[model samples]
Target: MRNLLILLVFFATSFGFSQELNCNVVVNAQLTGNENLQIYKTLEKQLTEFVNKTQWTKRKFKPQERIDCNIVINVTGQSGENFEASVQVQSSRPVFGSTYTTPVYNVNDKDFSFNYLEFQNLTYNENQYESNLISVLAFHINMVLGLDAESFSKEGGDPYFKQAQRIVNYSQQENFKGWKLEDGLQSKFALIDNILSPTFSDFRTVMYNYHRKGMDIMSTNDKDAKNEIALSLAYFRKMNANRPNSYLTRVFFDAKAEEIEQIFSSGPSVDVTTLIDLLNRVAPTHASKWRNIKF
Candidate 1:
C-alpha cells in the first residue's frame, strides 16, 4: 500500500469561453529521498496547465462558470525516471442561489506509477495511450465533468461518461495498473463502469434530485428543499439494496456526507431520526459520521 497525502490548493484564473475546469494540481515528493525538487516542480506546472487549459466540452464556460477541482500527486518513491505515487482527485460546484459550493466527486487512487522526464510536455490522444500520466489525468478529468453534468440534469452526463469509458477501453492496451477489469471494486475501471451501468440508473437520478431540487432550492425554500433531499435518500437506499457496496454509491456519500449532516442538523423541518435510520441502512460504512447528526 502506498502512502497518500492530499494537499488541496485552489487557483482562480480568468479565461475565455473554451476552458471548462479551474483545476489546481499539486505534486509533492518531499517524502522521497531525491533532494532536487526541480523535477517535481516542472511536473506540477505542466499538469496544472494540462488540466486547466484543455477544452473538454463543446459548450463554452466563462471563467467563473468553470468547475472547481483539485488533483494532488504524492510521490512516494523513485528509481531514476520511474516514480511511484498516488493521486487524490476531488471536484465541487457552486450551489444555485447560495454562496455554498457542494462537493460532487472525491477519490484517492493508489495505482499511479509512471516515468517522467523533466520539462517534457504532457500529450494525449483519445484513441491511443500517449503516456500513463496523461491517461490517468484525462480519465479523472472526464469523470469529474461527467459527475458535475449528472448533478444538474437527468443523465446529462452521458456524453462525458461515454468519453470516460472510451478512455478506459483504449487504455486497456497500455501496461498500466488501474485500467484493467479485475483491479478490484475501487479501481478506476469499476468507478466508470458502475456510473454507466443501467442497474445504477437510480443513483444518477438521486444525484439530480440531491443537487438540482435539493441544494439549489435550499436558500429560498428550506422546507421543500429538505423534503426533496429526503425523497432522494429513499432512492439512495434503494440503490444500496440493489447493489451492495457499490463504488459509485460510496463516492456519492463521500462527497455529500458532511453536507447532508449539516443540512438536516440545521433544518428544523427535517426528521433527523428517520434520516438516521435511512442513512444507517444505505451507508453503514459511515455509521460513525452519521452518529453526529442529532434529532
Candidate 2:
C-alpha cells in the first residue's frame, strides 16, 4: 500500500485529477474454464485503471489519505461479452498514532452480471445510466468513501452515500438486481437505504465512536479506548432492539468480529463481561467469536 502512495503522488503531480482511491483489483476466471485467458487479464487491467484513475470525490486527499481498498470479482460464467460473477469489496483505514489498519467495509455482491468487451471504455456519470459494470464499480467506490468518512466523523459519510444513492437511483432504470427494493435484504439497495434512514442512524455514530473515538485513541489509553468501544456497541444493542439481525448490523460485524475478538483478547484487561454479553445479544451470528474473548 505504501508503494501506491508514491504512484498517487505522481498522479496528483502529473494529472490534474485529485483521485481519492488506491484500489487493488482482481478479476478471477478460474471457474469459467475459458481458454481465452487474455481477455480476463485485459478486463482486470482496465478495471484497475478505471477504479484507481477515476476521481470519485471532489475533496482533495493527500496521497497518504487515499483510502485503501480491494475489489475481487470471481467470474463464474462467460458467454461472449456477457459475464456472470460475484464481487467482494472491502476497504480499510489506518488508525491514528498506530501502525494498525482496521477493516472498514467488507461486502460481497452476489448478483454481479455484466457485459464487457476488452478495451471498451467504462465511464460513470451519476445522473446517467451506463453499463452495470460501471455502475457497480462506481457504487462500491463511493461506498468505500462513505464508510471511510463515517469512521472519521459523525455522519461525514452522508455526502458520499448520497452519491451512491444517486448511482442506485439511476442504475435502477437499468434494472440491476442490487439497486431495487425487492432485490432481497442483502442487496446494495437495502444496505445504503438503511444507513440513510433516520430509523437506523445510530449505526453511523457507532462508526465514529468505534473508530475515531475508540481505535484512534487506543495508543493513549487502552482501557479508556476499550471502554469507548464497548460503549459504542450499546448503539448496536438499541438498533437490534428495533430491528433484529439487520443487514446493517450483519455488515458491521462481518468486518469487525475478528478485530473485536483481538481487541478484547489482548488489550490491557478491561471488564469485557458486559461487552461480551452485548455482543452475544446484538451480533449473535458471531457468537462463536464472542465466545473466544478470553479476557
For each candidate, what TM-score against the reference? 0.91, 0.94
Error of 1 at 108 (Å): 0.7
- Output the lDDT of residue 294, model 1: 74
In lDDT terms, how accurate is model 2?
Answer: 0.90
Estimate, for each residue in 31-143, the C-alpha lDDT of model 2 and write its tens digit: 98873699999999999999998878788888899999999999999988889999999999999998999999999999799999989988878778889999888888888
Q: How accurate is candidate 1 locally (lDDT)?
A: 0.85
Off by over 4 Å in 1: 1-17
Question: Could you tell me the TM-score of candidate 2?
Answer: 0.94
Candidate 2 residue runs with Cα over 4 Å from true position: 1-15
By lDDT, the best candidate is 2
Best by TM-score: 2
